[model samples]
Target: MTNMLLAVVVGLTAGAALRPAVVALAIPAGRPADCPACSPRPAGPTVLRLLSSGCENCRGQLLDAPWWLPPAATAAAFAAVAAGDATGWYAAAQYWIAFLGTALLLVDSAVQRLPDALTAPAAVGTLVLLAGAAAEGEPGSLPRAVAVAVAAGVLFTAFALGSMGLGDAKLAVSLGALLGWRSWQAAWAGLVLAFTLGALFAVFLLLVQRRSRKSTLALGPALIIGTLAVLATGP
Candidate 1:
């Protein structure tokens, strides 16, 4: 319990403290894009403000983010593995996997899109990280993670090929981390939740003018939400 609390504290503090830096990084340092999310009274404060705060690219939209969210997710993964059949290192890996998903979803949603720059590296990095984790710990889990990565990666890749952007497949790598070698329940639930949300988002577009009749919904956010939901439900 104490460790969980500490994790929560660290996650919250890091998220909040990092916000200014993130926003600062978003902007080009000199120009302002007139975003609706900003304070109108400021009348175009330096782009530095938004970039440092992670606000320029919709980073500010994460205002309601639970500070300890990542830590809590990590704790849950840890608990599941310790009490259930999963190994400790595998559980640790999933904690990060869940974090990456959740983080990407919010960031992409706020920006109204996901950049391939982010997704491409993430997909590759996740594979490398998982491979390393498997190598360092249990050997069998590596193969299982690989299978999960291929299955999930291909599924999302096919979806992107059919109707979405390529980033969707890259985002699937995150799900692979959570669902790999886990019970079938985790895999199915996460996948179901992601697509269900994606479909619902499409309907939402029709109801509101936020999106066009033909504009495709971003899959990064959907996958992120789905992964988080699965993580919360535990194995």
Candidate 2:
């Protein structure tokens, strides 16, 4: 219970801190990347601002983030702590994914695009943390993790030729490594669940008349959700 509470607090804090970056990066392509809220400001004040009423400069100019990010991030962290490996390193890896995955989901849902700024760092951070886990007596094969990541990237690249984007492909690399660290079956399950959830989401959107058959849906959130679900439920 204590650990869970700690995880929730950490998630809330981190998620709040991430709001500025989310507003900054969720812009449409070809637009200026500057965040009116935190641009030219140091990290300390930016984070502090998030804890308060947000930035004053970009009142309505920036993306209005959903109000549920902190709760969502808290859920992610709790899930990681509850279901992740006993070794602190593996739990840390899960927390990293949960944190960044929540941000990616929000950004993609809003803009229908995933920025390289988030995806690239997520990929690197997951890999590095997994390496730390391997060194600390975790029961996963780093080589297998790398191989699965490569294969997932290749496979998703093919999917990108269709409704998916290169951003999804890049995000897959990190998710694949995380799942593959468990087992091949977990990796396969995550992929299958992602597509299934995505299809279900599309159907829901259509039923509500929010999107048409030809409309491009954002799949990043589904992918992130599916990966997190598998991680939470997997042994």
**Highest lDDT model number:** 2
What candidate 1 gets wrong by more than 4 Å, as runs, is 17-51, 54-87, 136-140, 208-212
Against the unseen true structure, what C-alpha lDDT does each candidate score? 0.57, 0.78
Query: Highest TM-score, which number?
Result: 2
TM-score of 2: 0.84
lDDT of 2 by residue, 49-107 (tens): 34333444454445665666655665665556466434466667777888888888888
- Model 2 weakest 10-residue run by lDDT: 44-53
Residue 160 of model 2 has an lDDT of: 93
What tens digits encode model 1's per-residue C-alpha lDDT throughout 1-235?
5555554555555445444432332332244544447665245556554445334444453234454443454344344333333345555555455444444555555544555645665566666766766667653455665677778878877777677766677777656755665655677777889889988988887788676777756766677667656655543
Candidate 2's displacement at residue 87, Å, is 2.7
Q: All candidates: CA RMSD in angstroms?
A: 6.0, 4.4
Pairs clashing in candidate 2?
Answer: none
Instruction: Tell how far residue 28 is off in model 2, in angstroms.
Output: 3.0
- How well does each candidate superpose onto the true structure, as a TM-score? 0.65, 0.84
lDDT of 1: 0.57
